[model samples]
Target: MVRIDDLQVFIRAADNGSLSAAARQLDLSPAVASAALKRLEAAVGAQLLARSTRSLRLTVAGERYLEHARAALDALQSGSVALAQDRQALSGSLSLSMPSDLGRNLLRPWLDAFLQQHPGLSLQLQISDRVADLYRQPVDVALRYGVPEDSALVALPLAPDNRRVLCASPDYLARHGAPAAPQDLRRHSCLRFILGAAVHERWSFLRNGERQVVTVDGRWHSDDGEIVRNWALAGLGIAYKSRLDVLADLRAGRLQPLLEGYDTEQTPLYLVTPHRLMLSPAAVALRAHLQQCLDAYLAGPRAGEGRNDSCD
Candidate 1:
């Protein structure tokens, strides 16, 4: 008979691509995890994994069984959740990935309030500007800007009205003078954020019903979005950033919006998961809660009508 625990271990190992990493996530010792995999293989009557000293690969049989195994686990979890008398008493570990600026400035307070409401829950937050792999990494969900590139993931929009805007400090504008047109950016210093190998110096905007792409250059660049925002705040250069990341600064008069006549392109904010069925109850609740929070924030007085942050 194939034990359910053994199947779970097998599935986790496959998802992580390493037995030791999966073992740590599941809180199982290396020996026990290895034994569980062997038991699962014995019950299935196939060598489910091809293992070398450095890596592990799923065999054809393992590949065939993976989807079914995931479904089985999901069904079990669903049944368990259905039996709970208090649906609001959510208890589980949730691992999340998000960008540095948003995580530190905006979502931190929201997440703290969320955890307070459900004291049974624990959170593991991975804060970085780099994109995380939901399929291969230990992250359960990721809050990301822009459309997802991977078709295998499910993207739940948290803020559809979120957009990027070009901004600079008043001091910087006083010193360099604000650009009246996209082409005018060539004469100004711009701070850029790097995503992987690509520098995000190309900015897109719409003017007079026409799209314009401007290749910008700056005196400094960084991999972290927060660093770029900081540079813009310090009166170093102009920066194109998500409105959500700079809304407080913009409202506080620390940063001034530039090129109000032109419309900057909008990118969506999403809560992405590797598999819909694999999402835990905690993840589901959190997604809904975040959506509500964002909606309320957008509707609040601070988010005044016809504001650029409204993405209208």
Candidate 2:
């Protein structure tokens, strides 16, 4: 095998015109450096140098191989430098798998602004309700609500305090009086969402440190989260949705949060990667940008008294 150190010695010896000089430059004994040149020549089946007691210079074969060796070394060094830089600079492609409702309605604009700031950065977005298979899919990171079932995944909190808010459009509320409590939801039309195989029929809430679990029924149900939000917007029924997904609507007063005093369910948002080492610079920067956007959004005035309305 052709050792890289051998090639380095040959190149340096040829450039310096002295085996001893090259050995000193490389911090290797003269005998070791000379042996490296011989091993390299034997491996390549060519005499790479013609050395005398007074002088040392490249032979015909050495002249032919020197340029190629230098180029190979340069390529390897540059590759290492680029890889190290990639760990620090947000200048690469970032693939994100996110829920349809939040990805399209809420995060789209924020992510757009983020891309504008990083000209070299690009995005590949997979917007879906089904959980992304991190091992099977080409996803770099997943922006999802709720804890990851895979304990091995590195979940970076995007919105740890986010919740699942129960809300309905004003038109729906006017037609059928809003439910004042979690148990009251049984009397009104609810907009249910099917996550995977499970139907979200049971809703839970906490108020005054007491728990309330309601088995709610609705006329409408959809696998698509955005569709449920749309149905809620069209006054079809009350919807239980991720807070971030409905933040814009809540602010615009298009959807009114029901059960004011009662704290609804939690749906904390996370940026998930296969492992901590898999987290790239671009993903880290994107996480920061999304978090800042959420914080700023929550701080903004509510359409009404501008409730603190922290990003769920």
Candidate 3:
């Protein structure tokens, strides 16, 4: 049987377009990536990739083989999840990645409770504003907002990732005046989340059933959502934020919504893991616990309102 690690290298190299990029994603050296690909090809007795000075191209056989290998890895992961489901006690390390804002404000309490329940389970959670690779890093699961591009991973939708109201603090809104239309934002100070892929970095809105993309100019830009939130709360500028992030402030009249008739671009939230047949007990436990926490949180009184984090 071909080693799973070799197949993983093969898949990463194919997906990422270069051995070097794949190596970086996988935390391996370029030579290690190349060697693994060679080993995989040899074990399969087929030339999988055509390599040149500047580019890597997949052979027809490589395409078919990649599909099969990915399926096999997915089956393995699914099986692990199933095995974990049968166990009464979870005992393993589970690594998770999540956007820093959501992890800190929304899921912190639930995570604490979960850790208490599974004393043997160790967690390594990396809170990031950018998306991390599930196959590349040691993360077992990830909390992703928006639709996933990769078909290989299994994404379980946990909540309605709906449009949120964008606004500034009352003092800022009073000074800057609320945007009468989406176009009016061009004259206002906008705070932006400058991290993540370019796809998610831009602000989008809809008005009169027409969609608009605004390349916003901000006086302050940061990768950290908390910092952006603070800037908005300080009445520095307008921030386009999720209701989950700004709900409490809205209720308290700290921030006032602008362009009330326009739609705020929304992204769905999911608990994603490698699609496989077997998942470790710890990962399974965390996934379920996260879902429950999310459900309870969304249903609770604080669901749509923002919580105060002025210290942010």
Candidate 4:
């Protein structure tokens, strides 16, 4: 196969009318330029240059090939530039699956901003709390809170530092009072989530290296995480949720975080792709943007949105 570098060498040598001078212009050694010219001629099965001891010039075949070679190089350069531009620009459809709570509540603003930035792009978002089946679903990408269970799927960590936040509405806390400790949760109405067949009534927290598992009961329970968040917001019961899901609510003092001193179980968010994303430029850009939002959530509560860090 004739290399692009060899083609450049041939063109330069022909244009300059000196093999050694072409080497100087291309910043190549004289030997390398000579070898490239020989390789190009051999690949084409035609002697493109007629060189003697004193003078060098193109043969009859060389004059005919020069224009064609120049066009081939031009075409390649144009194709390369177009490919680069396509990669840089975001367009076309972005099919995504996201959790009900995070999708509907937390990411609405982020999605809005993204859409505004790319007018040519469109979104197909499936909002649900149930884990999306990449194989069965029409989703290109999925934003999930937990560590990816499927080893086959490619998981991109958006926020690896993300952890669950135990919280309740100020109204709910004002009514039922807050739990003083993890043990006290047993006495409180803890809103739970039911994933498939398993009930998540057992809330776990780490206090001073000791793990506490409190199995509390509540009247409100659902498979949908958003439902659990709504129930918590309506002052139904204490809900353990992702900080990113309830960041806006927390900022507005609608939900008050509990057990700040104690560590809640990690629920690192991941962007799962079925086959290494089959990802486009838009998908890659969106992932980066979403991660920034998640990072901001992990940065802790903002100023003036402060709550009493004291656990009671």
TM-score, every prediction: 0.75, 0.69, 0.76, 0.67
By TM-score: ranked, best first: 3, 1, 2, 4
lDDT of 1 by residue, 122-147 (tens): 99999999999886688999999988
- For lDDT, candidate 2 versus 4, the one ahead is 2
List per-candidate RMSD values in Å. 4.7, 16.4, 4.9, 17.3
Q: For candidate 1, which ten residues in a row score worst on lDDT?
A: 303-312
Q: What does candidate 4's lDDT look like per residue over 123-220, in tens digits?
A: 99999888887755668899988878776466889888878889999998888898888989987888898876798888889977899998889888
Clashing residue pairs for model 4? 180-312
Question: Which residue pairs come into collision in candidate 2?
Answer: 162-312, 302-306
Candidate 2, overall lDDT?
0.84
- Model 3, 1-312: lDDT tens per residue? 599888888887787768887788768998988899999999999999999889998999999898899888878867766765686577768788988777887777678788888788888889988788776677778888777889867788776564566889989977878887777888888887865545233578887788988777866888887788889999999998877667657777888878787778776778787654324667666777777766655554554345322111
State each model's CA lDDT, in order: 0.85, 0.84, 0.77, 0.81
The residue-level lDDT of candidate 1 at 263 comes to 89
Work out candidate 1's RMSD over C-alphas.
4.7
Task: State which candidate, 2 or 3, has the greater lDDT.
Answer: 2
Backbone clashes per model, in order?
0, 2, 20, 1
Candidate 2 per-residue C-alpha lDDT over 1-312 given as tens digits, one digit per residue, 9 for 90 to 100: 988899888877876689997788678999999899999999999998998999998889999998788777666655655586576556779899999998887788778888888889999999999999875577989998899987656798888999999999999999999887788999988899998899999999998899999998988998899999999999999999988888878887899999989988999999997654346667767888888878787666645433322332
